[model samples]
Target: MDVNRRNEMKKVIVSVKLRDILIGILIFNICIVIFSLIVVGVNKGNRQLKYGNTENKQIEHNNSKVDLDLKKEKDTILNKKIDSCINLYLTREKRIVKLDLEQYVLGVVSAEMPANFNIEALKAQAVAARTYAVCHTKHLVGGGCSLNANADICDSVHCQAYISQEKRMKTWPKKERAELYNKVKEAVESTRGQVLSYDGELVMNPYYFATSSGKTENSEEVFKESKPYLKSVESPGEEVAPKYKTQFKFSNANFTTVMNSQFKGLNLNSNIIKDKINILERSQGGSIKQIKIGNITTTGKMIRKLFGLPSANFTISFESTNIVFNCKGYGHGVGMSQWGAGVMAREGKKYDEILRHYYSGIEIKTLNYK
Candidate 1:
């Protein structure tokens, strides 16, 4: 072959090989991009399948539907009215401070009942606390705190137990403080301005306590005052309460000494303590109404107060070395039982229904004070 022609053929071959190499490289780059797109699409699908629908369904099942916009608007108007009208006297601080009524209700509900209780139970407590506050407020009823005449209501449990936001935050577990507080806030705000009333008047005493011995007492039996709304009623399903049943053991000497101290001239002897102690009368609700000890006849309420018993619904038994007082329920057993309310809530009862059940013939009324 001639030298020039051979050189031209070699250059053409080299150009063709370079073109083939460039086409192969382009195909490889296209494949890489396609694989990356497929990988990203798969990951996105997996994430949606794993998290999105499941989380939404869980939320829907766990929480009742709430209209956040409506709640916020109502809260704003309520807050303004309460800020102008309500004030509380803190016994510990010994000062009267003005606060929103709903805020005070939140504190009382949180302090008075377990925050972990069902939402309905908390709502019942919120309404009862609000009614108590309204009935006692000097601004509304001219009834001021008995302890301090300068204030509408006192913070102590004598009125209602209250804990400030700062103290509540400190008291609840760090991991759960915010969530628990939100639960309580929801309960208080959801039932805002609702109170218990009988015959167009705020119920004078919407009393409540920790637990009941299967039934609540008539007001006449416990408080010596007859309240039509506070009549005895069967309160069931409270066996799960922590204080449902309790025992306090007292040595014979200790029991005798305490009894003598409370009722003078009794001269109760340790050996004859069991013989001298006699239960004379019991209320319809199963709490001791009157008892005879030695030569003295005393009311069960007085004995309960003197010995620091949980309730008057107690049975006395003589042991070998100690006198055992087996008590059923906590508190006076005269009003709504908190544990009973919780059980009702879990059984799907609404807050208003629970309140009506406890306070006979009472109406749940919305406050119109502005």
Candidate 2:
């Protein structure tokens, strides 16, 4: 029965066992591959769901953060290109001090606009002040302070008001100084190296004032020069400003004396002042343009300066023995009104939106030195 039959059987048994083991290994390998494919598919779907639809993809919140970071980085690079110094003349100190342009912008923003204003409004003011400084930079643009040839600008309202950080700290209450300064600094830094330009040229005159009489004046009406961007525009929601409406009263004798002193050869009777004074022409923004008094035609601006009035948008009224001038708004009423900007900011307008509203046909461009 025998050795050959036994050896054949043993070989058959071994071959069958080997085939079973091979099949089992193949099945295990297939299961491993299938499990990996399933895991990968699940991960892909989760990624898609987290990101958004593939056809119309939406950014995740983190993506927005990344975009903001990139924008900040870009702004940092732009600011680095313009890290130049400015020579600012201190009018009270009668000295010229040089500082970084961005720092100067910070000072100007802190000085020109109230620190408690909305951040967007402060940003708008920062850009405007930066534009003014860059436009008047002596070496950069061939413009300088008229009073001081050695200085690029003066810390006077005639230019753009600027106060050092030390001075600003002193001006504000002790508890509010640090917070206010940080707010101003954030505004300037957020808009670093940005300026307003009209038709590819920097805005030469970015004039702004405290308030307006419902609307801003045209450049031609206020400065006698036509500026396309500085046209008449409505400035609403400024009635809440402190200087919205003011009054100046002068006795008939005092009024007559003041008028006669400015307009020589004019003899006016105090009793008939109301009848003799007449407003002949008014600007589109309701600012008095021309007025005649005792056969003398004078400009409203001249009268405003002579009498130290807040603005030229005034109405005349006779009160017993006194001549009363009711003035609406303040400053020159030719550009962006600070109070108006605050209103816009409160209504959720962005800084660029506020700037574009006041300065028409302008672009907010990043400064490039090269």
Candidate 3:
């Protein structure tokens, strides 16, 4: 090689070594500083831990690690309440739950049905509801307390269910009921936030809101404490049939007024009437003849019943079995008829669409946990 090239190469090598040495020395100094800081901190922490003000001391968290372990303590507690729901996994292997945050939020807001539900199906339903709330709350799972097994889902506040062991199993399936319960419990814990929650409070969904004497549901005026406690039920019927098969004074007027609350003076539109008018006892009453809307004949017994009434004071449209003229407020005379939101989702209906319909002002989002 040439002398100039060799000199240049030698100079570059020397410069490189000098740079590395300087960098190494700087790194060593930083490490020493960090070590000294850590030792000083540890000494201070140990002193406080061993002889801190006794009166002001807390439960004596051994270390920062214990202070961050609130999630396990909470899980130990909630697990005890619902021991039957089916198990689910965050992944295919089933290491963690699939529905976490949804469970927590829902747990604080809902509760299980009567003890005769299909646990697996109930768990699936809880997952779906979690899917719904996850969207609405804008919160995801697997983020520690932000989303964990600290929540309860598969509850009645979000959906109605039978309560009381005997009453629940009376008509529900045996195998299916157990399966649903077990599946739900597992699914709820497998994922993050699978229960009802609101603000900072962990709302335990008190099932079955009570109403007036014969009326069990008056959403606005619920029997706060009498909430249902059972877990799941395999079968659910259209509104539980009245105890007495035959009514002593059954009339369309009474059905619309007392049962449904419909009348000409009601001034409610066709949509409102449709929302509230349900046939709870179709197989056990007289047939309704006709109904008129502004002198126009509407379809079925609806229009006919409207024609005869004084518009303000309702009258019995009919009364008998096989075609019970039941004038109920709301179409799905069954469970949790969303006469309110049902009027909305119909403009465009999807599964999520139906969810937003019943649950007031909520969103729809999917789950993703790592």
In each prediction, how many residue pairs overlap at the backbone (N, C-alpha, C within less than 3 A)?
0, 0, 87
| Model 2, C-alpha of 104: deviation from truth (Å) | 0.5
Clashing pairs in 2: none
lDDT by residue for model 2 (238-349), tens: 9999999999998999989988887788999998888999999999999999999998998889889988999999999999999899999999998788999999999999
| Superior candidate under TM-score, 1 versus 3 | 1
Question: What TM-score does candidate 3 get on C-alpha atoms?
Answer: 0.26
* C-alpha local distance difference test of each model: 0.86, 0.89, 0.35
**TM-score: model 1 vs. ground truth:** 0.76
lDDT of 3 at 354: 34
lDDT of 1 at 199: 62
**Candidate 2 stretches greater than 4 Å from native:** 1-83
Q: What TM-score do all the candidates reach, one by one? A: 0.76, 0.77, 0.26
> Per-residue error at 27 for model 1, in Å?
99
Candidate 1 regions with alpha-carbon error over 4 angstroms: 1-84
For all predictions, the C-alpha RMSD in Å is 24.6, 22.6, 23.1
- The whole-model C-alpha lDDT of candidate 3 against the native structure comes to 0.35
Task: List, residue by residue over 1-370, the lDDT tens digit for candidate 3.
Answer: 9999999999999999999999999999999999999987997877654455543455454454573554443333233332222223222232433334433433422243222333333333454444334322212222222222433222223333213223444445776755544444554555443433222222233222211112113122222232222111111222342321222233334444432344345543333333344322221112222334332333333433433321111233323421133233322111122222222223344334433323323333223333
Ranking by lDDT: 2, 1, 3
